[model samples]
Target: MADAAALPSEALTPPGGGPGAGPGPGRAEGAEGLFVVLGAGLAAASHPLLYVKLLVQVGHEPLPPTIGRNVLGKKVLYLPGFFTYARHIVKVDGKRGLFRGLTPRLISSTLSTVTRGNVKKAFPLEDMEHVSNKDDMKTSLRKVVKETSHEMMMQCVSRVVSHPLHAYVSVLLVISMRCMVQFIGREVKYSGVFSAIVRIFKEEGILGFFVGVVPHIVGDVIFLWCCNLLAHFINTYAVDDNFSQASVIRSYTKFVMGIAMSMLTYPFLLVGDLMAVNNCGLRAGLPPYAPVFTSWIHCWRYLSAQGQLFRGSSLVFRRAPMQAACFPID
Candidate 1:
């Protein structure tokens, strides 16, 4: 029952406290991996729900100032759907229910926005109007392609880097506030914005902030390379009608991109999630409770007949060759 830390390098001592131990490590390390994969599927697959929620919140919810604003100056908002549902549920359950995963979502949202913004600036793939002004179709097209690729890569890396935070936060949103409190006990109350910041700094130190960063960078970078760029590309070439479907097309594009992004970067997200869970998300945070498979099954159950959500995902790549001239969606 010796302390594993004190034990010899090669020895495998008793876990938490056999005779002379403290805490034990079991499947804790592997837990986040499951969340990452599960999280991506949940986000990617149920995108319509997310969009619908956002639409409702922007129309009829009490949230931070960023709802319909093009730029959320200092918003403290949740994802559109989760927040909407949460607000309704909280009306019945109280404040605890409405803001369950506030911390991780805040962190992840900031990171995603920053990542997307920077990548947009760096690549500006969607700004083909400026880049293509030279009137040289061949040159303009090549430039667009390169810029799009670059944007995708940047977005992918950013998403990967931010995956654990996203996954942790999403799980927090899924579980009820009462359940979270039951599981986390005293720590939950102490984990507000100020407390979480100080705790992470003290416990993880500077090195801790970068937890799961590498794997996420890899995963998200690839995610952007595929899906996000597809959005930018769709904007650039395909389905260029100035009508109602334009918005629909964009939404559908984001959905497809979300799936592609999720599929390609899932393993990386899984690795990152595993790291976050092991670091004390279960007791100290909102994730680490839900199993990976269960979440996917949950997503599919609700994803049956959403109409336009999954409409163009399969044809996302196919749009490329035809992109020289867009085909009518109607």
Candidate 2:
């Protein structure tokens, strides 16, 4: 998923007044800290949903599908929704279990945020000028293109620098032994984070830490370019400056556009997550549950063929796949 905090919608300017001055150094630092804290808090709060989503993505459906009605009021077999799936997790491992693998995720988010900020500071945009809608259409368009290009460049550089941390987190939380312990039937191997890291290194070596990074970076780049370009065009051409709620409308536009673009790029994320876990020693990554993918391309092709690219995109109102539904429920 795209990190809203790291988006280049607004440039980070140094303290004091300029054409479009940003917050001062101390204030900026404090704000970044608050962002990290709030981000971590949100991650902790939403961990359960993500936990269930990951399991579902890996085809680890411990609970059977239940009868439910769709939005159309048609009767259908629905896989366990968030509450049902979460309740099962609580039953098996208590409330604390819902937070499994959260530590690495939090750390990852914080590191990414900090690293991006520092990198941006190190390579600040030169002659940073705010593009005004008041300017002539051709001039505004030119400025927007220039600014957007700079922003995308900065985003790519920051992403490359910070991606190792992201990869590490994916290793620990997506397909690693640490995350597998959250599943009910998986055998407990490594007891904690440090031990799990050591074991992965011993078995899979350094490459193990970077399993799903390529697709992830690609997804982020695609998302950033699409979302940023579209938002700039809308805000520049579509939204009128004289409108009273112009800012509000533009904000909503960016949010909604980001979501739409995310859906389009979601398959990249799905493939990345699957590759991270594939053939990684857990049953979830092994045969019957999943095939031994030679590379992310193979995984992508398999998922595309199975029409399971968006397997865990929705948490609530999940419908079982036809093949899964055909199997006799225990």
Candidate 3:
């Protein structure tokens, strides 16, 4: 009877009983917990939008008209732009074509989200509570700036930690069947994910894995900061402070806010995507379409030279409405 009573007390007591050693740190607490979080995140990150967005961005490059003879020997000119590329994807690979690079994207993005969340919790910045209704415009702007800065810091930290996965994601995005055929030509094809991975490893070695990290990190920071600021603005200015249990208004506000955020940040996303898959031809064992830009500045410079830096901005804006709603819906 005494041992049973003591057992309850012991279970409730801290390990040190002094202060710090209560429960273990929750950040990736154990191998099981780590695996579970990563597994769940991996599944969640395999969203169709991942592939769609990448494809849309990659298809921004204008393809030359392919001249061929029809059944009657008539001249047929096929030009591959965004829509044509999308059609080719569907015609060639069917529905499954839309899911190219899902595996590596799932892994990279899941790890990024998890790591960012952990880093955010561990190294919190200025509390949002300080920004109040009574604050002046300048004060409010300052608060938003702080919030954006905090988000960027957290994202950068996570990006570095997940750099290898990020590089793999970039490589996969570039060499995925849809990208390989549409962006390059049908001549170069990856057998599947495994073959693509091995091919990258052998061809470029370790540094190859870090191929597009710089652009990705830069784009991620800018997008996150802008999105968070916009969301904060909407939440503060647009949303009602008091709400009942089943608040349709709040839900709608969130949905609209998300869509607006997606649209606003898309240009930066275009730059990132361009830099990311910039090496697609090289990765496919063909001559690279453009010289490898060593940094974000170089990438931007190259794009600016071609006058196509904002090539996919319209497509991204058009897709933002559906893409953004997925966030709040999920």
Sort by TM-score, top down from the best: 2, 3, 1
- Assess candidate 1 and give its lDDT: 0.39
For each candidate, the alpha-carbon lDDT, in order, equals 0.39, 0.65, 0.49
> Per-residue error at 7 for model 3, in Å?
49
Ordering by lDDT: 2, 3, 1
Expressed as tens digits, the lDDT of each residue in 1-330 for candidate 3 is 011100111112222321222356653355335654654464444434444445444543333454445578765543343455566667767867655555655555556556755775588664444343535647877877877677677767766655555333334433332233342354344455566667667876766555655665665665556555665566566655565522445334433444544554455555555565565443422234456666657767766776646544443213222322343321
Clashing pairs in 2: none
Each prediction's TM-score versus the true structure: 0.40, 0.83, 0.56
**Model 1 off-target regions past 4 Å?**
1-95, 107-115, 118-126, 129-141, 152-186, 228-257, 281-330
**Deviation from native of the Cα of residue 84 in model 1, angstroms:** 17
For 1-330, candidate 2 gives per-residue lDDT tens digits of 422332332332222322223457877777777766776787678767777777777777888888777788777788888898889988988998787777666665566666666666776766534354556657766765776666666666654544433322234433232364336444565445576667667888877767776777677777766776787778777888789988777666656777777777777777777777777666667777779999888988999999988887788778888876675543
State the TM-score for model 1. 0.40
